[model samples]
Target chain A: MNRKVTPAALALAFSTAVTLAASPALAAGDKDKGDKEKCYGVALAGKNDCKAGPGTTCSGSSNRDYQGNAWKYVPKGTCKEIPSPTSPTGKGQLQPFQEKG
Target chain B: MRGGGAGAGLSERLRGAGGLTVEERWAVALLDPEAPTPPDLTSWNGSDPGQRFAVYRNNVVVSLVESLAQTFPVTCELVGEEFFRAMGREFVRARPPRSTLLARYGEGFAEFVDGFPPAASVPYLADMARLEMHCLAALHAADADPAAPQVLEAALREPECLPALRLRLHPSLRCLRSEFAVFSLWDAHRGELEISQVNPLAAECGWILRSGLEVRLLPMCAGDCDFVEALARGNSFGEAAEAAAGDREFDLGRCLATLLRWGMVTSVNGIK
Candidate 1:
């Protein structure tokens, strides 16, 4: 990274990495970025956007990486260009990933 | 298994035989340890489910109280752990968690403290607790990009648009006015001031906010507090300044410089 990623980004990465990466069903509730769509497999564990899953006891509590249900708000056109270590295609996807390994 | 026994019908009547829904039974059972287990819990039974129910009830209430203690650390510190735990026990039983957002756990605790006789000796404690709660809220609010200095300058160049220009303050901003020196007390507890010499009678006014992910609690004078409060309450810059005029020689330029310097104003909207 060329610049400081920010504490907020680190926290965001930790939270969005969970269920939002795994399940697409819960991603629709969030309406913060109207022009953005749910980008999966991009948020690192504990970096998911918005609220955590059902067992989320506290704020920003994601403990898993590339969580299928966890998602990030990516510009509508840029999701596929982003890289994901866990995604089968080695890049982010607009919808939830079907992890191969 | 009742062999036409009249007792069977009475017990049945108590457990949904007449009216209580499954959810109601479970909810009622949680509050009253003596109540029979809800019809849905079919896992165990050496005898009456009251013992099992009591165990589950204790765990739930204890966890909720623990949540409160975590949410209001300052409040817990003020009353000591044991006293706060006891108070939390009573608080949970009286007013249970209505929202699932644990981050917002103690929203009503200040109100509860106001009515609690044991805590009445320290009348200002509730307001202090309220301040702490607001601090938590500010820390967790959404991220917003502040309006650049040039943006403010451009808006000011057109004074006629001032009243219509709605300033978008940072999402984490909150103003609080209180009778006690809560900012000092909170600061003292945090090692910013000496707790022993801090006076409780001194009135304090301030706002709590997060600047670039760092939560800050800053004290303000009467005029500045009222000025910001008016704007936060939805008054335009012109209207907010006009409302704040009664607050002892309010200085608009100084207040504007301070607000702009701190990056509190995010985006100025509402002009055609």
Candidate 2:
């Protein structure tokens, strides 16, 4: 399949593409508002106050075992939004969304 | 959950073993929950420094986990809050940030998810993580101006120079090819489509770039993906076209239209 597209063919295709690309009709996909609205609360995660060190006043606490390897939890987020291939009814049969404890 | 005393014991063991500084020991104890509060640590409240250290340790780990959750919300959403936090906690403990650039933290998380055991059920979770990371990177990538329409129009005048003309894409442009319908899954999350309507097994090539103030995900055929990647690698128009044409479904005109319309082409070079 080494048959190269001739120079004429390449030129024709590229010119046609350039013309089409210039049309405003093709720009309909540009929908994102460029604002942080979607990433609002999420972006705040890393921007926490840069305290000199961890302060005793910062009351965040999570005591779960870090190294323990056990798989009792299953995906129950938007994954539930997808229909399971295994479901006999062809509906979303995944578990209910498990709220944070 | 070993106490601050265990940390002190480990600190002593390390000191006996030799060569560690007080600061290094303090850093290690802060991230490791089982490690005791550093012996040198003192509290202002006159309460036990060990208990205070425990609070500090928890805060440090929680903040890092929170960062991971923020950067990979889709990953968090896919696994649910509890599982994601648990997995994030494990990740935070295993791999702490090396640089103070918190925004760039968790760059390796996608790869980490690929090898993680608990995430094995959602086979596409790793790819989803990768897509999320790419989106964030694109969002923060340096800005560049797209080639003006006149530049491309002028280049079109010299048909013979087409093969030599190289297109420069925007700095934020990122393309990814995934075996899973990762683009669809992301699109589903973005509210463009219902998640249940997507087939997770469908292979897709994702095109991402921050055009103007907005980051956009453009749908691409396999040919378009290969074409853009070639151009991004500095291939000329003819070379990229040839590569793209290898796919039977290649449509050069449509692909070019998409790139130009999205403001992806920053410059058209080597055209005399």
Judging by TM-score against the true structure, name the best candidate: 2
Pairs with steric clashes in candidate 2? B4-B36, B4-B37, B7-B36
Q: Please give me the DockQ of candidate 2 compared with the native complex.
A: 0.25
In TM-score terms, candidate 2 sits at: 0.76
lDDT tens digits by residue: candidate 2, A9-101: 877887887878766666544433332121111112222111112232221121221101111112234323443333333323222221122
Tens-place lDDT digits, model 2, residues B1-272: 22335545665644522366566778888888887667656667779888888888999999999888877877888889999999888888788999998777888888888999999999889988888888788877997777887888788888889888889988888888888998888888767999999999998886888865456777678888888888988888888888888788878888887787777888989778
| Model 2: residue B263 alpha-carbon error in angstroms | 0.6
TM-score of each: 0.66, 0.76
Model 1, position B170, has a per-residue lDDT of 78
Which sections of candidate 1 miss by over 4 Å? A1-101, B1-18, B34-40, B44-49, B270-272
lDDT of 1: 0.69
